[model samples]
Target: MEMNIIETINRFPDQSSCIAYLEGLRWQNEPECPYCKSKRSSKRHETYRHQCHGCNRSYSVLVGTIFESTKLPLTQWFLAISLILNAKKGLSARQLSRDLGVNRKTGWYLQMRIRKAMQEGEDVSLFKGIVEIDETYIGGKKANHSKKKRQARRDNKLQITGYQDKQPVIGLLERDGRIRLQVVDKAHGVTIKPIIEKTVSKDATIVTDGFGGYAGLSKIFREHQVLNKDKEQYARGKYHTNTIEGFWTLLKRGIYGQYHKISARYLQSYLDEFTFKYNHRDNRLIFDVLINKIAAVT
Candidate 1:
């Protein structure tokens, strides 16, 4: 679908049109009973609800999806989904509040629910190709309460410790195909090595920077190369981590520029959201693809 598809969707301002659209997506052949999965079902008082002939249970098209329990108009829900996927840097709850013309709390709740839908599954296969690995720290402002005392007072400030305080992000870029990102536990060898084994194929070439953690991954990867930035070697012949470095640039921009400061607890969801967008950059209908995920089961 094109951007104009959203305009057409806008024409359907009523709930009936929204229900029909959702029905088409939820069921391809016939409107089967969501409860019993029976083809024999009857409409309830011309409403969206349907009754199963076998078990006599009633169900709406949204019973099993993320749309369950939401009271907003289906049209507004679709509009919100489209706006979210169309925006490049991602949207905040306050921004959605103003745009959707809903109360700030409602918008916040809606965005959080949508974020839940964006989360990637754990059992999904890891990325494979010339995968590049890296990590970064994310934390909010530091208080300058007492700017007294000697010896570089800035150094005395409490640095956030553990992967819990600072988000441990690892990115795997598959040459030109797709990028897989995860919030790791730590930057240590034990934490990072297992991820490398899972994501990259044994025959794939792996590129990373000079980190002691990634030292031994060369044995597993077909050709592992390191670009020691301190030694002034960012690239050696065809070996470099620039591709993943470029991804880090986009991620930091989204974090610092757009969202400002995402809490460590919810950092992974945000990373998955960005990674989903990055991997599908080439798809012209990315908005549609992501919206489908909301309807998709785990």
Candidate 2:
């Protein structure tokens, strides 16, 4: 079962409990040397570190994982992980800092480290079985809708072209299964088609709104379903893109509501976080699922 905030705190009340949890999950028998991958190791006296006989080195369960080099206590790290995983709309770094009694900088670093583990590989398996594809533009909150901000941006010569001001993000969701999200330079066929081809399988049927970018998809995939909203024909049979659109609503609420502002440089990482949570929303052990993911990440 997923661990709630209180349960998470109770489970790892101290640093030693957190270390023991990691040790049990990372190794079944004796602790293995991360450097040499050998099980020949002994616990250091009065310390969590272990001595490896194979490489003549010392290590801990935190070695090479997301917790590596972190100065924060293991209990706090575990609590942060639990908080992040439990936040459906996402918990901001400032809020985390306030919650954990840490400064904003440390909270930001902690979040960024955890987010790094959420990244998805580009070569992950294709999405089959009725896929829904869509694109949306994300950016700051209308430049705060303030004339002063707008004037400042204009004085600095910032982009004012409505959609151009925002970053284009494409989402391809496999109906009731997994979803893939990517930030792209354009919503045109040139940039989007390649992503569709690589991320989606040829056998899967594709559904999308009436976007010119997806015009060529009919030829590449086995079947393409389009809902020409221009004619107000939405859901002609099962061709609607409602599923992915609903997902967009959630993502936008999280980014625009929870985060408020996200730099384009790190936009994809934010996408990865949303994707991870969405993909595992159904799992009863979602907290444990994220923990396992953290265990595998370096």
On TM-score, the candidate that comes out on top is 2
lDDT score, candidate 2 = 0.86
lDDT (10s digit) by residue, model 2, range 1-298 = 3578899888889998888777777785458888989898889999999999999999988888899888899888888888898899999999999999999999998888888877766757889989999999998657465798788778999866678568999999998899989999878889999999998999999999888999988888999998888898879776678899899999999998889989989899889889988888888787776666677633
Give the range where candidate 2 is weakest over 10 consecutive residues by summed lDDT: 289-298
Candidate 2 Cα deviation (angstroms), residue 215: 1.9
Residues 180-247 of candidate 1 have per-residue lDDT tens digits of 77777777889878877876779898888888988888787788888889989988886777888877
Model 1: lDDT to the true structure: 0.73
| lDDT at residue 239 of model 1 (Cα atoms) | 74
The pairs that clash in candidate 1 are none
